[model samples]
Target: MRLSMPWFVRLAVIVVFATGLQAAPAPALAGSDQPPGMIAAVVARVRDSVMRIVVVHPPEAPPGEKTMAKAGEGHPVTRIGSGFVIDPDGLVATNRHVVENATAIFVATPDGGRFRAEIVGMPHKADIALLRIHTGYKLPAIKWGNSDALRPGDTVIAIGSPFGFDNTVTAGIVSSVNRDIMETPFDDYIQTDAAINHGNSGGPLFNINGEVVGMNSVLYAPGTYSGSVGLGFAIPSNDLRFVLSRLEEYGQVRAGMLPFRTQSVTAMMAEAIGSPAPGGALIAALGPRGDEMNGLIQPGDVIRTFNGEVVTDPRDLARKAARAPIGSTVRLGICRSGTIMAVNVPILAYDPHPQPIQEPGPPPKMLGLQFSAAEGSDGTIRGVAVSAIDPTGSAADSGLQTGDIILRVQQQPISTPEQARAALQARAAAKQPYAAVLVERNEKRTWIPVALPGE
Candidate 1:
């Protein structure tokens, strides 16, 4: 017969098992239980100070019509983007493209009040601009977070107008730091996937603590009508702050610029340039003449370092070069003609004169045709020769090619780059949908259609 256990013993065993299970702690909550961190508090404190900007645009003139206004004059145009208040006096920061040609700029606050704003200054090379709004109302201003402290995978929040939706919040992680996708002199961009869009330009990208770390800018994609494909870029707060301080002090951006045009090299191309291994940066060209006459450096030189930063590629060199202060002597480790050497070059302040990034008066919308002035020689083609065409640009789609000299635009003699701009302006005023340019490629001249920006 089995021995019967006492009822008290049985109860004791059950109690011991139950006590062991209860000793295990419940799962901790997702957020810190005590309180939101200082960072979160910081972010919440500045959310309302941001603004959505709306600008009015002027209609384009007709073709063959003398400009009612002089060349390089302003026309009214409508633009929409986002910005954040930076001062109690209503200073705001935004992207240059947002107010590039604004006749009038207005900012609408989250509280539904609107105020007129003035463009304080703009830096074309840096792609940054500053504006001031005199609302006479106290507005919240955001505190800037240090961009140097940012790391990949850090949580970030982007608040902006996406597709005209105001104050939309999208969360994401910092995809990258110090990205140099564009050829801008100052190109330290913060890559994120925070759902940026058409109306998001100039808006702030915040860290979890809500401090502004970057200014949302471009999307990496083709075509005018496209959505974010998880690739969005921002101007780091470090750079934005630098530009802002300079603008407030100098009324323009004053930064160092190298006198050279560079092309990024891949591993394969690095080898072609005679790099010891398949990894390094190369100088593609010196500046377009005047500035290049200084002749401190030459093309085909492999740059190993700049200003103490390791230069892995052309972009790295550009990023470091741009960040160096103007009037400073920058140390460069260069490899030329299979020989390594060190040189110090004085960096110049960024050229403030807006040299047309593209050919001046070239149609706003690029057809992707690049033309150059002809040389002084008989039997040489004259006028605007299509030296290169962008495969993805409108001209490439239209079958334009290299060595093609454009003689006429819309039946107007296109003798020079200035003439080309005038012809395009006239055609645009005429309400002509497109301007036909006469081109000579391979000694055969024919007419090609060029599209204007607003058309």
Candidate 2:
């Protein structure tokens, strides 16, 4: 807990606790009434561990190509950020946004030592990323602190290169903990008034004991001002440790997925369902994403707790589910039909972004009828996707909807919108009455005899 004090008394509060020895008098500040040497001692131990990150973004690639140019792509953009060493062997932690899409990453030390760094871990659920550098010399690593023990009004120190100024230090009290800035699903941030700005994206936020408690990732600035207005947020150290550990072991973190879709309990729904309070996850949908439950669970079951922890709502359960280990059975408290019972549910691995299947033919283009093609990552053309349709148009009248992909027309396979248009134009010249349009919607295919215009 923090002892709220005047601006002038902060240095004294930390200095007194840092150096509790009675043998000698501590050093004093040059011109201030507050005592000194505590902040200096803390920065002295961890500043060398802090690094200036310089990232070179790869050139924009032409459609379906690795990169636009062969070597030395022109107009390479550079981004600067900050990071701190977590392992002596050169494992550095920073925000993923700092080095995202970076072709090459470089790190510089306070002693002018520089080396190329590589991204080791980038988790989808968390904004944190890990980088590794090789160096023969011994490196200074920062000490880890318990973010769970932190509370509002606790003292904190931020170190980073704000606006390209290296080694800038700012001090403030933690405005709050467990602060959800709506950044991520598992957002538990340490909100402080420290002067964090651009270029401080990945710097470390240290506690009064000089231990690294969080990493400065984001800041708030009103209006057109890009500079700090004393509002900064850091990802808690406890959250970072889990991602780091998983990355080191599995090369990626696996988020646990729930079998059933859930909704937040409302006051009216709670009273109707016999729940004492409007808190818990209400199972909204079952049987599609929920087939794994094996009919043991049903819809309308309110999950009151997960693995013995009382859930505040659906979001709380989601956050807890992400942290749970996959392939493990978790005990859930359920309120169903006015009876409270326990149910064991298995956690599954979540695949957030799955690649779409490609069509294995020509490239994509859109012309008349607002048709576009879906292209896969490896240059393979997918089916022609319908982006929009006129409500009064024949396509919409024949059951074609947005997000439906045109698979074939008139019993001919079509890969692109250009192909679909060409085939239809030929069929129109032949004066066909109705075209058997095969379209895929939501992974299901159906034939719709769309009436040809001017027929």
Candidate 3:
């Protein structure tokens, strides 16, 4: 049986939303004092807007088949996340990861009504997804806050479905701000002590004034199914609001990208190179036959700024550049070969669908690691092999080198990138926070532990 929210939650919602302020004061519990009145009021006003999202993926058919088996196909697979109403027209905002590949999405409000949703737009790299529900009724819209004004130690509230518990509220202080957690290339997250769990993914994080400040998205945990540990992160409303506006206007996000990979240079490396790094990004390499060759950026260069924003770290550069509009010429400040130079870069929109190939192709470079197919008649494994190495990639940092074949991930054997993705999904469903990939490098074996994206 489906359980409804407790009566107390509804009453609290009425008291706070109706008065728009804290109640006079609660009677002291025999010789004990109650918590702050303002904190309690904020939670009540925001809780009702938080929702539970139950996403269903279409079932699979036999290999090489396009349709589902009429009788043999199992029930539609479902995953639970969270979301909130963004506009009065029934428009809702959620994490792209939540609705990606969902065949059916159900948004359940605190009032106990569930409505079907249609995905309007989603930018995978930005990790933002927008959905619309045909509710045919007026909805409560949240006031967006200025994320730029946020500071460390600010009190915040997270509202969402935790373990399928709809409208669960958790309060905490902003542990930090402007943290460059590498979960997303454009990640400039607001770190909070709020408890964000598996089902908390698309929920709203509110400031004390009842405005939506950020979106609860990720947490640092040992495994997926683990509960809150006081270290959770949210995508700031400032960036998300920008993406939301673009999505509403263009039906997609147009972000600029340089065909290059970079990292922050340490003080020691900067001293050795005689460059005043001051912790800016160092250009490592460029994409092959891509826009980068158009004289945008080069290797052994220190990037100082992107479009006038100081690039204090590699993540900062990536984040600022990613938010730029596509087709716009962005100015970049760099120190190349001991000479400070400036270059104009054109931003381009990346394609959601990669070109399809019938037969297996050469290796692909991701996060700086180079991979190719394994040799032998191993029918179980089939993918572009890893033949090279990126000494700066997470794989390389985890001790992966040349001649390594990625055989299994999280203990599940994989023959292709698709299979590896499936293994990762399985681990995610089980609430496994991190994954370890077992690789065969140089005819030997070892494990490369990588944190899953957006976790």
Candidate 4:
């Protein structure tokens, strides 16, 4: 039931994944034209490794609850996604979002076998999940591809369950690489024209040789549109491989961190910094450890290179730092006061389960509202009480009622009423037909889709 509305709270469509190179010319098969065995051969080779996942959650499970009530608490909510076999011992790979909230998971293969699957491991930050099923015999697994070698216009093939249609194949070229849709601090996504739909979230995006190049993950479309608009994104296989390795070995993914908070240098900033062109990552802010690095790499210093490699931007530095070998000191080329210099900084592994920082929470920020959407000066809406519901309105039709309180819209806390209004308005203006809403009623919370009114 949780079709993740990630960076697309503005554009309202569900996502799908796909990629494949055009097949080489050969003898025509039964079907007909196009190239001989292009897409067909690739699909035939790897389709069996693809998986169909059926997840059952407690109907009353709050949205995004990682662990839910064991199945059969109430009417179970069934949601479907896709995955692929990664190991012959029944290990599977999938998007983290697919099974994050699942109470019960079922995996089906092309050979007519269905088995219960359990979460083997998953990274805290990346959208990658690993599952393991106990199959008596060896299961077919996919061959890994080099995502770093992918280029714009390279072909790709995707296999998944779109709308519960299992093993569905779609192909498209790489639209671009290293896309930053802001999903995470490490946001290098492979943009593709593959038809990734609502149910294609965790499937495999294959190259022409039947090797898995990426995992179908996110998509872009009009808010009201139900189909992919040839704009889909996938987690690159190299990143996926790294996360999987960390998850299996460490029980979590580890990322390397430099001491200071940074942002990309802009043209104006470059001019002020006396640079020839706009480039390099600029240290904009500092944390505690950043204070330590600040002495050597002060604020306003542009990181021109990392370990002798040219640093393109903030994201490039992030990726390089995250994937850098642990305990290794890397050289940072920095420009400060218009002078270039080098400093060796030890890569720091981020603590995944550190004690929660005691936030500025002495006086809990509150907004006045048992009915009206009263919000604090900081723009956080406490609990917007639904004073009344129009019987014929979309909320009412979605089973919302008077006295119900709105908790979040699209996984984000409604900041101010105006921000909430504008976000919904933008989705409506973009012709997005529905808004995913979280509501509390009778002291319980649940997610529901509220249809936005037509223009």
Candidate 5:
């Protein structure tokens, strides 16, 4: 028989075992020298609104079999992601892909309370979705920050569940602003090195002041395992606000169109056009439906401003046009033939499948380059192919080489030498200083501003 141990001895043994098993103290946070407790304070302010999203999909059917499952009868395919509440009534914002094709959705808050969620609306083009849950009590909402005010190197915080770890906090600076990932036409991602991963999609990217400035969405990883490699992208809160407003008003986001294709002005093109610097968007082509503004605005015109806002590049014009109110008249400041002109055009709903306009007549040869009809592989005339270039002339000085096909001059198509000559003569008659020429070289197309002779 063994003797029983004293109460003090038993207590001492329990304490020793518990102390030995205790987890090692967490490491101090890196990358910042904030006063003690600053991070904890910020986290406390917004952590309650951060949430984890769970999506359940119906089971897959057998090969080539149209197997349909009864209510809740199929095997559940589960997906996990993150989201944040933007309204006290249980409205949540998340990535569209997270809830796409989901049979059931659920939201889990920080306090371990879970609720069923329903999709309010999702704009596929923007990759943003809104969800609503019926929480008995009002939930905390995050405050929106001005994304436009963000600059490169500004401190930012990313909050989400990475690899199923709930409420993981990562801090990094803004790697870049106005990043275009090319995933969609409305791409204007805020890039940061905030350790975003697969499950981080739809989580809030906070500014230093605990305000939501972006929504973490995409990670740039190119291997079998998709993990953050210090390159992550987020949707700007400004754009998100616009999408949310449209979703609330019309149940869908509406994109307005300018009905024209544009290119960025190069320094050479600007000098040729008599502009002081390389700025503004050069109109390349207009859609057939854009003919309503044919007389007011023409191809080859440089758009300098839209609705009193300066447009420094093609992307800027596109973004402004997309955000414009449909059917509202807007003013455009255009530079045509080195002269400034104003035109008002009514914005129309964007046409996803716009009809192509008829190609214009042949371009004129103001520069010392001879052009002939180019033959395509199918023996069809594609454009005016360069036959000869005068070595001492403007064409040679502007970098036009032999075999460079003259596609268009001032946005007018060219097929024969005579048409090109006529187009040049028209510019000469108008006393224009130069002509913007579109040339195809080695299958690549570019715009070259050829200075007019005797300008």
Candidate 6:
């Protein structure tokens, strides 16, 4: 007996057969044109290492209460996210926002086994966090790939639990690299078209070689919609490796501060400064208490390199500075008056809270500027107000006007002329070339590089 099939059904069958044949070609003896099963093999290799993290948060306290209720006592709030094992000893990495304020964390494996996790360390500046789970045995871990070597259009796979669905796999190409989403100061995200969603936070972004290259962290959604629009961002594995190293050594990440504010060099500013290209970071303002006393880096100077690494812009300088060892000295390549010069500056540990400056005694007459305590409208001391300027002195040449208020010298507040003189004398005693002065003019604050006069 003969049977007839519908035209649409026959077409669908033919398409399916052709796709299957393309996906999995028959085994050939020699010199056959057949595609390798790369994606399938990659998924099989790394899917078992991905984990679903469930966090139980402590209950909120009553209004106006000083303390929160203890964990496991109040109503439980649960949060779910994804993570991956990075070490065989059960070291897992995830987003800090995932386990933030979590009283208890649980990790679920692919084989229906659950284990308790302990928070190892979480860096404040970066969104990465490390956790340790005691599985009582060695767990499968993923190998790290070089995110810096990734080019646009490289094949990548994302494995995570999207919306509580476990082990969801998606594949796409790298859309871009070194993307700054403006979410954090250290934003060097690897942009991909991988399908990442709410529960996919902290999942592993894998390369074609089954190596972890990035950590899926965020996605861009259109207005009023909370789904991925093919714009997914992952924290590059290179930055994550740095954070992990710091966490292992110090239990927290410690970044070195350059003690200065910088702005991206524009084409107009570059021309004004006689720079051939607009790629360096321009020194906009010196920190109130930075290492600018050596006169190495100054206002109007452009930074082109840090420790022999080329600085493309302000963010590059910041990233390089933050990675440097605290209290260690590094050389900075700077451009001044169209001349390239190198200056060695010591990196200082970042201080979130700085001490307030106190008033000093009588003023010295060495410098050619007169300073007095200025008062606000309510009669409060504002700063050391500049009363006079010597026209032929370095202060006047550096654009110090009479009405400008001397707020700080070398980043320390100056309440009296004596303090300003002392700072200047210290710089001179150290044989420093210039002193960074913070001046308030017309309700705006600016940093001026004043050349110290020879004794």
The best candidate by TM-score is 4
Estimate the lDDT of model 3: 0.66
lDDT for each candidate structure: 0.66, 0.71, 0.66, 0.71, 0.73, 0.73
Q: Once model 1 is optimally superposed onto the true structure by TM-score, how far is the C-alpha of residue 123 displaced, in angstroms?
A: 2.0
RMSD to the true structure for each prediction, in A, is 23.7, 21.7, 19.8, 16.7, 30.7, 27.7
**After superposing candidate 4, which stretches have Cα over 4 Å from the reference?**
1-34, 61-73, 354-455
Rank candidates, lDDT, best first: 6, 5, 4, 2, 3, 1
RMSD of 2: 21.7
lDDT of 1: 0.66
| Deviation from native of the Cα of residue 248 in model 1, angstroms | 1.4
TM-scores vs. true structure, each candidate: 0.61, 0.65, 0.65, 0.69, 0.67, 0.67
Model 4 agreement with the true structure over 370-432: per-residue lDDT tens digits: 246745459986657655433223232344555567778786787455665665567667776
How many residue pairs of model 1 clash at the backbone?
19
Q: Scored by Cα lDDT, where does model 6 land?
A: 0.73
- Residue-wise C-alpha lDDT for candidate 5, range 1-455, written one tens digit per residue: 01122210100000011123332222233236566666668888898899988665545677897645332233334567889998998999987777776555668899966666777767656667888888789999999999999988777888887656689888777889988655654567898877776678789999888999999887776544455567888889998888877766666777787888778799999877765568888888887777766567777889999989998787778778889988888999989888888999988787554332211112223355666788889999887877765432333335466677887889898878788778876876777646788889989999976645444
Report clash pairs, candidate 5. 363-420, 364-420, 365-420
Off by over 4 Å in 5: 1-33, 61-67, 70-74, 272-274, 351-455
Candidate number with greatest lDDT: 6
- How far is 368's C-alpha from truth in model 4 (Å)? 44
lDDT of 1 by residue, 224-277 (tens): 434565577888998788789878787776666777676656777766766665
Which scores higher on TM-score, 2 or 6?
6
Please estimate how well model 4 matches the true structure, expressed as its whole-model Cα lDDT.
0.71
